[model samples]
Target: MAEEDEGPQKAVADPETYRESLDAWMKMQMPAAEDLRVHAVDMPRATGFSNETVFFSATWSQAGEQTTHRYVARIEPPDGGLFPIQTRECEISCELQHRIMSAIKDSGVAPIPELLPFEPDTGVLGRPFFVMEFIEGLVPADVPRYTQAGFLVDDATPADRERMVRDAVETMGALAGLDWRTMGLDWLDVKAKGQPSLQDQIELYRDYVDRELSGREHPILSASLDWLDANAPSAPVGISWGDSRLGNMIWKNYRCASVCDWEAVSLCPPEADIGWFVMFDRMSYDDFDVPRLEGFPTREEQVAIWEAKSGRTVGHTIDYWEIFGAMRFDAIMIKLGDRMARAGIVPAEPGISIDNGTTDGLGRLLERQGVSL
Candidate 1:
């Protein structure tokens, strides 16, 4: 979920165009509001290079009274965005996101924005998109590195920061505890084996790396994949919030108000999500050699909180999952870097995407674990 230095040049179409299209669409959804208007359409600067996210406000009439509501639209990227294979193949479609969030909202297991119906017709906005109630809360900014600057570091007291961490972990635990089958989310098990096996998750990424590389050699990823195949551990199949991190949550009153970003939602073990959460903390602080902000719980402390909240044991298995998280992240970087280069946001050259901090971190992790390249 790393943000590029410069915003993607064409993350969305013209705001005016969106305003027009969305206005008409919202009318259909609310036929009673004859004077409904969509305005203030915009793309947030801090959004990562994943789905194109647009925020706008709509004003309409109800009972002869004017009312306004803010909403966010998640659009499919023209270039398939990050995780190109998943988006292109419909493994991670907007409809799936809508269904997942809707289930989670009904389960009340976690906080999610209220959603509208999913719009599968690309003609609505040039791509499939879903509109949801815009949540009013502060999201940890990815562009500025929340550790260095943001309400997370600059304004929040130590106690507040601690509370944020605890609350986020608790939310994750709640989500992990949910039963996908009971929630009618069995379709997320892409392999359709009753549940998504750990091996299937690993192979999915291996296939992703191969497709993203297109024959380009990535030694660190290859070695990590080999190690994973040989040392895969068994764990309960549970819900994975795919990209779990502080940046993905919207906070209100130092507590998680809404959980966003469901493109990576899967049926992997809960450990995968925890691994991602911890791995990103390392990337934000340790990888950059930045001192972690005061008051945030240590890695062990955070895991302990998760254990208590989720009622699950996470022992050495976390080490394996952390490496798994790193590998998945590195694989995504390959596609992300290429997308940036092609957009002229970064230099276009060989190895421009692969030879970077993510790969380096993956290499160091393998070395520390005695996995030789």
Candidate 2:
């Protein structure tokens, strides 16, 4: 039998415990009221990235009435699957999602599940984590897996899939539509945020690849870099969903409920987002999937879509960033595979509970998923 979860506990073996830990913190954040009802907010299970994830039911009492609800918390990895190892005091990579989501919530682009709190107290749980609203609708990824086998829900129809896809794309446009400068996070120190250029991105990945892959040689790797260098996209970078793949987008009712896992958000080539969608969504490549550019629509098609949606002629050649982003995924995963003692490994979280669940049963760093719902 699957292990039963206990009070605001931790799942260190997994990453999702951030949710539980977050609730624990929320209990403190919200002032207890005679009119408020609160009970054991336990997390069950949810899946994304290499973190330990669990969902739970909540009941808070108010004015002799009970308020029941649900929400999700993202904690540090109890296992593995975090990537792009950096030797620094703080990581821009790790905190990317937290910062951007906070901004998006402020910007009013798309809906975001309300954030409760984030904290890292080993004494409380086991590691660092945050909490957010639990989206109760049919999260796109689960419907197919939990609902059927080999039915290929992915093949249901382009219309349903289109809603999902449109949401993903439009979310990008919605975000890109924002003015970063007005947002106040527009310009960050290069040292802190790293250079927001194709070259800076390339060098960062190159270093990541050399250290993680032990400098493993792949012809495609060099070809990809050479291609990006040769055919670099035009400059003045806006926000790019560094990992804007299908899985990163959270869908509900055939439309995007939230664009999440902002773990890869960065200021790089605007086309980078479009390119990443092509590599991961269109080409059916996992993080490691690299595609031949000739078969896909011309760079013009992508620019047209972005320009039409974002209302700006941002980039006409994102093929470079697409190739770069795909390679980045491969390099990160290769590093993850190296670090994991088990198949899944994640960053260290203080006091986070570790889930010793059976392999991939909890969907930690899933190897197979699709762009369509």
Candidate 3:
């Protein structure tokens, strides 16, 4: 796998270094006489552009008893990250972790790993990182694409694959139905410069293109943003899982066991999330040559389940939202590609850009909208 081959070489911290730092921190948290030893401190090959996740096992002795636990540490990029802190309106990563976990508490929509602690002081490690219980389940890989190579397609029965898709969409629907303000998630409602949250996202992406990818011309993204501005939907506002997709979920027993990665949680139209989820699925097949798992819900079936569970119609705006989804991916890939190039992961100019698939896919959608890129 590309991730397995490249991840270890590109990792920012060594396993030995991680264990030393984590053990020291854990020892301080335990009783004075208690012993805290960390082992199996390996960064998962699933590290992505946004955050670094490392898994480890810890054994501690306290009051004549010893216990061992598996945990995950999600760390912010020590240097500049793909999503820069300056571009965001929320607090730092640690604070955001607390806020998101607090909002979803007792919601009963799906299981989430228990958030342990947010270490602000970088003295223990080079950068602040938060710990959570390590969820044990099947997480679809992205680099090779799950459809192309993963336990989901390689091992699971067709029925289980179908259940995975349906349950994942249902989880999204439950989230869209959530009352953010009632759940005390109003903190995610940042100042949108007097514009609706959806509009704010459009502007934000456009700004990212201009400032983050200066001297670059992304015709498809530019066209999609313009179309969004012209055809802004009047859909009801709701919570949007910014990175909504089946890949972000941990599956066990053919159902979504846990939904993780709330970095892009926001107040936006419900369609925004559905669009993202749909486009990601579409890309897996259309761009990567990865076939959709048999028995999974079709696009129409997914929408039907979403409407039933969310208790709202996507109406005629579903197409528009999907286009927005493709565009959003393109915008983020602009940064992702640049990051990889700077790190020498890939050449400065590849035949097809890192975001080529998403950009081309969005172009086809634009033609349907009578817009040219």
**TM-scores, in order shown?**
0.92, 0.71, 0.88
Give the TM-score ranking, best first.
Answer: 1, 3, 2
Give the 10-residue window scoring lowest on summed lDDT in candidate 1: 83-92
Candidate 3 lDDT over residue span 48-74, tens digit each: 466678889989777899888999888
Q: Better model by TM-score, 1 or 3?
A: 1
250 in model 1: Cα distance from truth in Å?
0.4
Q: Using lDDT, give the best candidate's number.
A: 1
TM-score of candidate 3 on Cα atoms, chains taken together: 0.88
Using lDDT as the yardstick, the better of models 1 and 3 is 1
Q: All predictions: root-mean-square deviation over Cα? A: 5.3, 9.8, 5.7
The whole-model lDDT of each prediction reads: 0.82, 0.53, 0.75
Can you list the residue pairs that collide in candidate 1? Answer: none
Best by TM-score: 1
Off by over 4 Å in 1: 1-12, 45-48, 84-89
By lDDT, rank the candidates, best first: 1, 3, 2
